[model samples]
Target chain A: MDLTPLFLPQSVAVIGVSSSNDRHPANVIFSKNLLRYPVRTHAVNPKGGVLHGEKVFPSVSAVPEEVDLAVVAVRAEYVGSVLQECIAAGVKSAIVISGGFSESGRDDLQTGLVDLAARHDFPFVGPNCLGLYSPGIIDTFFLPAERMVQPPKGGVAIVSQSGGILVDLLVKFADEGVGISCAISIGNKAIIRERQLLEFLASDSRTGVIVFYVEGFARDEGRDFVRMARDCGKPVIVMKAGKTNEGGRAVSSHTASLAGDYQVFRSVLKQHGVIEARNEYELASYCEALSCYSDKSIEGRIGIVTGSGGHGAMAVDACISKGLSVPGFSESIRQQLQDGFSASIRSIAAVGNPVDLTGSALENDFVSAVETLSITPEIDCILLLLLPYLPGISSDLGASISQVYRRSGKPLVAYVPHVEKYRMLIEGFELNRVPVASSIESAVNMTSVLRRCRPC
Target chain B: MLKKEIQNILDSSREVGWVLEPNAKSLLHMAGLPVPRYGWAENIEEAASMAAEIGYPIAAKVVSPAVVHKTEVQGVSLGIDSQEKLQEFYRKMSILPEFAGILVEEMVEGEELIVGATIDYQFGPTVLFGIGGTAVEVYKDVALRMAPLAPEDMSSMLQELKGGKLLAGYRGKEPIKFSALTEVLLSFSDLLMDIAPFIESIDLNPLLCSAQGCVVADARIILADQ
Candidate 1:
């Protein structure tokens, strides 16, 4: 499946532009693509006069020149006709952003569109979805720019069943400054499903890690997913929902009961080297870490360098709970870490495994400690818990820390929690490819996954 | 060897369902799986004689198409050490109308394990491994793998069982030879793969695993409808 046109389209046509209301979803998507994205956008309304000062084409066929992709934002009733027009106009890829299809109990409409897409052999995203948002390339989410925040462009591609969940995760990722490769809302999965997208993204240079938020799988697609993920050679993270209550909820065999379909799903995925995330937070954290340092592999031992003793203890507990080792720094490494800092910092901080740099520790203190452990044979990875409220620390410390992290080649994840005020420092770390987790638990969770991750 | 034996069972079958004990044991043995020594005895005297030859400790089970759960029907007698005991137990069980013959077999004592294969509705022939016994349904500590399995897959499946630690010698008990268990799992997977189309389900309930090696204590193979 050559999905290049679907993801990398140069020009896109929004098929249902409302003439009267600017609040219409189609118009909203059109305006977002026009103002923020690089793709050329065309508006289509049957009563065509103008939309956003660009001449609205009466139909897709009426649009001048070839369009690579079509965004079908019309009502579910007229979606099939618009698709036919797109096919007639030689459009190869499309995203059906309309609702009232299968999800609204209109199976006939969904089936008709599925059949139409099949006959044309062109891939379409969804019938009731937020649509595709390939950062810098295209943004088809109907939600307006101000309301729907977009994460910076990076290497993690998200394919989710719920559009609302995708938006929530995107907002969080944006706030944390986690870069994204593509965010696809595969609602109803009418035409293109997870397997096809996974196959496409597996070879995609832009996508380093593939994350799935699936409500359910279609029959044998689960088996196909496992096979493809094994061969993809990239880390695949799945956050499967409806697992606790879905298939085999009333099973007969103890094996089937204890190893329910969900357990089997998890085991099979893990057996194939796919990381399974238990919740939305872990899914996002794993995506951030894996996308940033997909090339590096960590093995258990983590070096914790934090500004506060309380945060360091919390991180240690989290790591230990997940079967990760937070080994005490060796005598030589400990002595080196202590020597790098002045007496004021050393007297206040604990020079142990969860190396507490104390509240007064400065930027150079953090850099030197991390730089030493980065080369230390015992430490497999590094975690920095920075609380910028301390008078000695400034956001400028991010640049120096990021530089030291890059030079070390060890997987480094930062946790900077407070609120929106710390955005600059967080962005500074993320800009240089260091993912910042929201909490201590998630920071350790990401560390554990990265440690177990073996690059194929 | 297995192909010829399976063909014979299919040719001689007048009805479908559980394959008879002799046939099931023959299938297992042909696939290089271990089964306790036993024979179909024609009479009470023959049952006693077979038990004496197989050794002092043995068991006798009534084999009949009407009785799927033999123990539930009170059709099984265990620990027949002497001829007097064998004859006495056989007299009580052989009177049942469903009794086809008496199967005198060696009594295997070890940790109970269940190895089963089913034609999954979606993934096709899948093998299951877990602790066996009546609590098999309650303590559903099992793992499944699509057959035929690789060597490593077999080991991992065993390791995944809730009772996996028992095989590794828990407490003061000697560990059941790991290679022996692996052999049984691998052979079962191969057999399931071979007869997957005709077989609906194959269960080796209470497949005994001990320091002596693994052996099939009870075996049943359910055939699919033509």
Candidate 2:
């Protein structure tokens, strides 16, 4: 059995709800939403029924219809009895959001839970985790999945082994404006391995790009999985968890797995065409890039249009870092970009591969320059760099810049080289399906990821 | 003792495939494994006398260790019916590279087994085993285990093969002694473990299994330190 109910949970019983505690709202929030989606909702408590006017079932077995999912939010000791009732009633999935079991170094409970999960064939998500959401069906997100679910699902699917970390990434990606197809919190992966989910995602049309958060993968099985990703023509970006020396040990505790031959894994990943991300955020950036190329019909030579000389120079530096060579600027495209700028801003130029349009280049200069650069015989994609407050630049900016990028349908990546200026720019591009990174490092890393993803 | 002598020989020689058998016997002598008593001769007269001393039906092999796969060169004569055959084997042994004297010894009788280690391109050194001797290629049953192992692990490894029953003396014969096997295994491990990085590989094929004990009849060790 796929343990269908745990992920696609229909009715949920949330244990441990209290009014006095601040974090206690977690049970109520999920319970309220589970009721709203009209999944059979039960408030399991010894205190009696009637929380938000719904009759509470004293135990999981007491509830009438089949309980698809049960969220055990009590102390770790009480979790066993709660699970016993669920198993007795034949509940298929359980999301154990309580802690102090294995992570606490406790033996009996942890081993018992492992044995229990295997016997029932009921895959449990986490012993300590932020629960997931199926969007429209249920928003059981502890980190507030509703605010994080940005509209219009493009084709980016996620199979994250880390529940807490995955939720953090989901929130960040949602805030950045990239919609998710289905982000799975496949905690521990005691039963369902990454390869099986990868195969499932490959068959799903909703997934254009697959971002895997791997703490560990079975040794030789990884090579076959990478080959399968290539066969499907889906860009699989991996943010491997065990890169650090400390992360290696932590991976064993997080998931019972051995970190094997990282250097050899990297070599094999390259051989099978898996794009490796340096970090979690960069992995997300690569996924977004592939999502655009897979779902949208955006293509052609790139144009690096920028507000400052540093911004343009930084983009060029990033392009090289990502293993991409800047398209040569012919005399005709060069003169047009020059004409789009003021005479003073155009001529003091340390003129080169990245058309440095000087600090005086405003929003309109960006729009005009991109239009002229796109018509060039050389450029196929545009890497647009903009600083939020250029000395003479207007504040009403990104709207006009957005129009030009939107009109061309040419892939334009926008970024503000400083961390503080990144938020608003990220939001602007987030709405447009264009990526806007906050730092030179993130922006360059994003482009490098883009170079690996072929826009189908 | 002979291993050290072989080392001195290897340390001096700049050629390859030349020190094949004698060099192997030297390694076996150093490891304290049982080896055949033989005489090395510079001439056919010397080879005939050595064969006579070894008694009738002695094994006479060409002395050039360079002649790997000696049967390919018509360089070996086993159970020689006469002194004339010993003279013929001695003459052929002289033609091969680094040709020394001939070896005339009483050949051991029993099942032959192959024990070897090959350096894999990815996973370092791997130890291999199978039923051996000249007809070994026919059975084609082999087992492999990673190296740098303990003596205790070897028995578990021995038990893995389907032919373990036969090795343990099936029917009426005595079981292939683990003590004899352990000695060779410990010697093999020390040769690999003690030298550190010097050895790249070691192949001991046709490790003769006699009624008394196991004898390393032929072997090869490739050095990496050079």
Candidate 3:
């Protein structure tokens, strides 16, 4: 199916627009595209008045120009007719933002829409979704723009099964200054599925990494998903839910018991080199890390340089649990690190795998340690546990670490606790392209993802 | 092309149940899977002759289409070193209503492993590997992949098992040759792919693996209703 109009429409019509009520979802969507997207916006209302100083046509067929796409935000009872009108008008595709279909015990309504779309031979998104976002081209999210946080434009593309989760993720991306090429919410997935989006995004020049929040897979699409993932030539990360009672609970046979639906799904995803994130934080962190360092090769071996002993131990545990090795530095690398530090700092610091450059350590101590470890042949990646509370440590230390990261060409992830005052210190590392995580565990998780990324 | 034995099995299976022993062994052998030397015996004298030919300390089981679990029905008897013992076991097996004949075969003792294929609702033609023996149901230690599986996939599937160390020669035992195991798994995957339409599932429980090689000790091929 050609998804051009659904994502990159030249012109869009918002059906069921309420001219008088500015807060209606259709009106908000109209206002949002009018102010931002380059595409021309057309509003349709049966009343056929003016909205935002533009004429509101009585229906999509009455629109002046060819409608590339239509956003069906009309009432549930009238959604099928609106889609019929759209089909008649020769609109290429649509996103049905109206709710109350399958999600609200209205299977008849949902089936009607599905049949209508099939008859028209056009692709459409959900009858209960926030719709699609194509960076600067079109965004059909009807939530008020003031309440939404837009992420900077970059390489990650997100496909979600739940709108609320997508919204939360976008806000997190915006807060972290992480950029996304596109974000699509595929609620109910009556027709369009992640597999379709995956095929489209695989060739998309803008998307370097693809992430999905999937509740379940459609009937036989799991195999195709795996095949596509293997051949896509891009990193695919998935967070699949509904495994508790996903499918086939009352099964017979040892194969059925051991290879239950979820277990097979998990194993297949892993076998195809798709990273599976367990939680929202891992999803966000892995996305950030992969987006920034997707081209860099990171082996599972890690070299840790920390300012706190306890945090260092925790980072070691976290990395080891995730199949990442934290090997001790060889004598030559250890000597170079020890020689680079000052005598007083050397007396207090532990120059080993988790090179604990203690609280009394100065800025040069971190710079030298990272520089030494980054050049070490045995080290594949570096984890910097930066504690701003250490009086000798400050935001300037991030630049030195970032410089080594650039020169060394090894992946680096920083962990800074969420101290209110340490915001700039965290940004200091982030602004330099060093992905920072809020906790040690998350940083290690991102490191594991980077290790799994296909080598450039 | 499927062998004549499997073609006949497919032609005759009218309901959803386990295929008979001769059909199962024939299909396994036709797919290039290793199985102990064996032959069907219609009478006690034939059973004793086959046991002697296969060389002593043999295992014998009643071949019945109606009885799916031979051990539960006391249809199986092991360690028959003499002709008298073999004849006695064959006579005991012949009285059962479902008994068609007796299967006389060489005995194989080694670490047990389970391998199987099932048509998953979501992902079709999935192959499985796991720890086996009587504890097959109790432990349920297994890993799965969609067929047809590659060599690396077979190795990783074995690695995923909880008792995976047994394949690597656990407890002073020589490591089972991985090349031989890989061939069995690859052939099993090919067979599942080939007859995917006619079969519901295939279970080769307690596949014996030792320093020498691996063999399908017991097999059950469940046919989908025609």
Best by lDDT: 3
Lowest summed lDDT across 10 adjacent residues in model 3 chain A is found at A245-254
> Native contact fraction of candidate 3?
0.56
lDDT (10s digit) by residue, model 1, range A133-216: 888899888888888787888888999999999999898777656678999998989878999999999999998988899877
lDDT, model 2, position A45: 67
Instruction: Give the per-residue lDDT digits (tens) of candidate 3, residues B100-163.
Output: 8998889998778899988876778899888887678788888888888987897688777878
**DockQ of each two-chain model:** 0.32, 0.03, 0.60
* Candidate 1: tens digits of C-alpha lDDT, residues B80-192: 78888888877777777766787889998889999887765435567778899767877877787766777878677776776788778799899987788888998888888
Alpha-carbon deviation at A423 in model 3, angstroms: 2.0
Candidate 1, position B48, lDDT = 73
- Top DockQ: which candidate number? 3
Local distance difference test, per candidate?
A: 0.83, 0.64, 0.86
Assign candidate 1 its CAPRI class.
acceptable
Give the lDDT of residue A250 in candidate 3.
56
Candidates sorted on TM-score, descending: 3, 1, 2
lDDT of 3 by residue, A1-456 (tens): 888777788999999889668889899999999998899999999899888788999989899999999998888999888888888889989899989988899999999989888877879999799998877988899888788888999899999999999999998887766789999998988888889999999988899999999887876688899889888989999988877755546543567566777788888888888889888888888988988897876778999999889999999999989999999878888889999997779888898889999988888898999989888989788999988888887777777789888887888899888677888887777778899888888889889998888774
Model 1 residue A365 lDDT? 87
Query: Model 3: which docking level applies?
Result: medium
Cα lDDT over the full model 1: 0.83
